[model samples]
Target chain A: MSEFQNPKARKRGLVIQEMPGEMLVYDTETNKAHCLNDSAAFVWASCDGVNTISDIVREFEANSKGTVTEDFVWLAIDQLSSKGLLEAKVEPKFKGKSRRDVLKTIGLVSVAALPIIASLAAPQSALAATSCNCSSNSDCALQAGMCTTQMCDNRGMTPSFTCVA
Target chain B: MTSLQYGQNFISFGVAIRFESTNARLLQKAVKTANKALIGNLKPTQKPPEHTFVFGRNKELGTFVEHNGSIVAENEIERGVFKYFDSYLRVRIGEYCPDRVFVHSGAVGINGKALLIPGNSFSGKSTLVLELVKLGAEYFSDEFAILDKHGRVHPYARPINMRTTDGKYRPYTVDVSDKADLKKRKPLPVGAVLFTSYKANAPFRPKRLSPAEGIMTIAPYTLPILVNPAYSIQVLHEVMNGALIVKSKRTHAPRFGEKLLQYLAKVM
Candidate 1:
């Protein structure tokens, strides 16, 4: 990662919803959903394959979001890149440093809120959350090899479902 | 191949389905079972069914249920066949329904607004919903919260299948149809969404979720999310915009339901 290098946000295969002080981005390719707070959303919006790290910091200040250090902008970039929101993957700048140390250093001098993105993977099959009764391995709700069911045995009573590896 | 002796076409949530059976008696039983599976969600349709389910008996397979030519469930007991088909049909409809999104949630209405508690089976949602109904909140559903394109919740008021306190935790249905004013039931605007699971003796300290965070939390339980990501996200945005979303760990249903109503009465 370089301060002079320009970054672009990935726009393809994503569904985004902009809400008050937050943005929701769903990656259709990976089935991952990310919730970006205002600070991170601003940084992502500014990444148009044109703005350098220094330029993003200046834009942040111009928008009256308060003064932010270049390190703070890097923190958001590292997260966005790792989450596959960037057009090109950037090597993590804080690879060897603990997140708490980085946050502490950024929080000490930056007046703006710390950038945070919360993410969750949408299940490939919603049936994974619900119960399923299967007569064969193929009918199991979960991914292959993780779930296998026993032969259906009711014997004139309620059905019993058994899972075996 | 066994000749299909009886069949019926039905529409549920805009998804057309046909149920066929080699035995006339089994077909009649299946019709009754399908009605219970969706509650008031199903109706007869003239359109060709997009999915077809067949029920039949054979010497080798005994009794079986098939969907689109694949065997879904097989058992010697007739009761088990219908039980498995009931669950299968619900999941199928939830997965492919074109017009509505089905979330595995328990919904109730208070002051004409719906409160949705989203969770999978055995999460104690049914117990909480029953308690809420006992406390005079109008019961919407104990299984699913069917959301239309506008994000309004329509009632899927089926009998609450409450798990027994015995060690087995077997489910038993408690019919509240007498209490559910189905004649007057209509779609209710979402007032709030609560994400909670039973944790014995855990204090009910709910933290508010941002709209974006709320959508992320509910995405896994949303059935059509993977099928139609754009439409699902659009509807979820509509839901979180006007609704209060919160998450917490709850204690027993009776005690927590009482406290929850008080908390909602103040906040919502």
Candidate 2:
């Protein structure tokens, strides 16, 4: 929306380094590295700057087989962008490779907001993987990577996480 | 397996695990510090029944743990569930067991590869790593897993070059035999690295550690300089050696073994 990007900015602004058991983001401005452990890595990768924050939230829904709200994505993104790691790029020009992904007709798809899933049940080694049966955002009480064996959703979501009986 | 009240401060709820293959110097050092520093801090409580715990089923280990309320084991693999509660930490062992790393404290999990188990105790490191082999993780070594200057995981030993569960400690096992023991000696390359923290809510999260962060995490673990200062320098260089590093949360066991196996198969 705003033409604030510098034309001569180098690509030296962001660096992603994968080390033993960790993911790190190096910010040029602060000369500091922000680390993302295992679960965070999954979120960081799908937080594509090209997509609106809502689009990225949907990506996690698809990945976790769960749904979450637009606000969650915005909350996550705003925090990341505030660190100067994310930069807005001008929309790419129409190119031949882009055509392969889809028909170019402009259209609209219904976007549903899903709540975080927080299961408290302890994980069992033999439980069957349930299909994404969630219908709304309220179904997910657990956010992403919860420790303690299972999810911790007390209300507003079905119990999925395993806990000590 | 007798209780000699070693410390006034360190109160152990659930079970207190002791290493049978005793390296007295290290044990005494750890215990003595607890005795001196834990006077006002130690508090004993009823074992939380919900704090479900497990240990090697060997009759010998069971007897020892029963008498001592602590299992003294190392060099042998005990694939079972167990939990330990302390004031500062609650260890869940044997969930998704971590892979072994060759460092000053003994074997530990590699940083960022696919193994899911992380635990305390240097001796258990290699035994748990052996278990990682069962989950389809590439076998490294049982002892002295090393970090190269380029940040790659190298083998410090082949099989676990540590002590074994011999003598009176033999009954607590599904397989009570001399051959099933995890003995010391050998090295291999590490594909992943992990930094482990002990907390209850901690689940298996395989993460990628940044190079500088890797150096920081490896610092405390690599402290007291196991070999020469050069070895630590070598470890520092090796931490940056290009393998993956991760931070893990563990309690009691090779926690998160099955789930980790499931997750790693897709990632690595």
Candidate 3:
């Protein structure tokens, strides 16, 4: 296993919406919205550049009323880094370990096995917003430092083909 | 800022437009059509509106503008006027409503709370909502669910926007007060969230969703989440408390509506 280090959340252009047990994070920089479950949210919020892997696992155990292993924190950190939610990339400690080895090593419940982050690309406005029904690609909004490819593809529904990107 | 007054007032989404113009007949037609398209047949009150804006027609240019008191559009007055009106009403509601999070979803009252169905265009939201309404559920809205900070839902009543078989869109309004079949209801807390759509030959199979899953499913349809992410997240989170969320695929609405309500009653 690699040495553990504190992680930090990215600070710019990030909007977070919290539900009862999950967080919806909209990263304007990437033009993507991510849904982090309670476990993942807790891990992300706890990343203060101070909490080590062992510290996070203890915090999870205290609040979740369940046991967790350091591997769980590592799994979450892996996802956060991949999604650009972290300030820096985190190297997975179990790089050489297979899925079976990791599961056996952690010995956590199914729910605590790992964190899951679901995401989707959302338009700047509603699908029915006038901007979405653009006349051409020039009219489509720019995202991630690039112009979104816009085309008409509604199969002649009503006003013919409505623009989509 | 030119100010003209003719003592005519029209209100929608708590925003008022005091009509002021020499073209009184045209002003009346514009108000009526705009009200029909944006708001239901709500009674105009003597109490002052929350926000007031002046509306006037430019007889010379054959155009009109409200709120900003500028020539926002010129020519094609009929279409331009209502389009601008719709946009203004939407913005006004979002700005004025402090506690409500405006979500782009169809909602109906079931079990003294709301059943919100979230989806975008071509997702069969309207068709499913119509079915729920036909099955004796109180209609909240076909387009938006005005969810309060406490998570209760208020009515944003408007005509149902339905597409005909030929793919032509049309608005159909239901007179709840007069309709004997439809039940009358007030704003209620959210009891359930259904993430569903019509699928050909897809059996009425439903999978329950966690609160996290529910938030993600509805996130795309919640308008306020996009506008004020931090505040919206908290509001929607609280709004979802004690609500049953289901992700389901069904072959039909009328048949599935019965089963769905039964499921909600048992769970909620």
Regions of model 3 farther than 4 Å from truth: A1-4, A10-33, A57-71, A87-111, A120-122, A126-165, B1-30, B37-77, B80-88, B166-184
TM-score of the A chain in candidate 2? 0.39
lDDT of each: 0.83, 0.36, 0.65
Local error of candidate 2 at A49, Å?
Answer: 40
In terms of TM-score, which candidate is stronger, 2 or 3? 3
Q: Give the TM-score of candidate 2.
A: 0.30
- lDDT tens string, model 3, B1-268? 3435444555555445454555666666656655665556335666555544444556575555545454433344455455545544564455345556878788898758898988765566777788888888888877788877688887767666565554323334444423332335456888888888788778767788777566666766766555566666677777666787888887777788788877877788
Kindly report which residue pairs in candidate 1 clash with one another: none
Ranking by TM-score: 1, 3, 2
* lDDT digits (tens) for residues A1-165 of candidate 1: 543268899999999999989899999999899999999999999999989999999999999998999999999999999999999998888899999999999999999999999999976666555543444434533422223222333221123232221
Cα deviation in Å at residue B259, candidate 3?
2.8
Strongest candidate by DockQ = 1
For residues B1-268, could you state the per-residue lDDT of candidate 2 as single tens digits? Answer: 3323332122332233332212334334444333322222224444322222122234333311121343322112221111111111111211111222234323333333423222233324544555555554554434233444343444322334222345212111122112322233223344455566556656776677555566444533342122223344344545455445666665433555565555545654
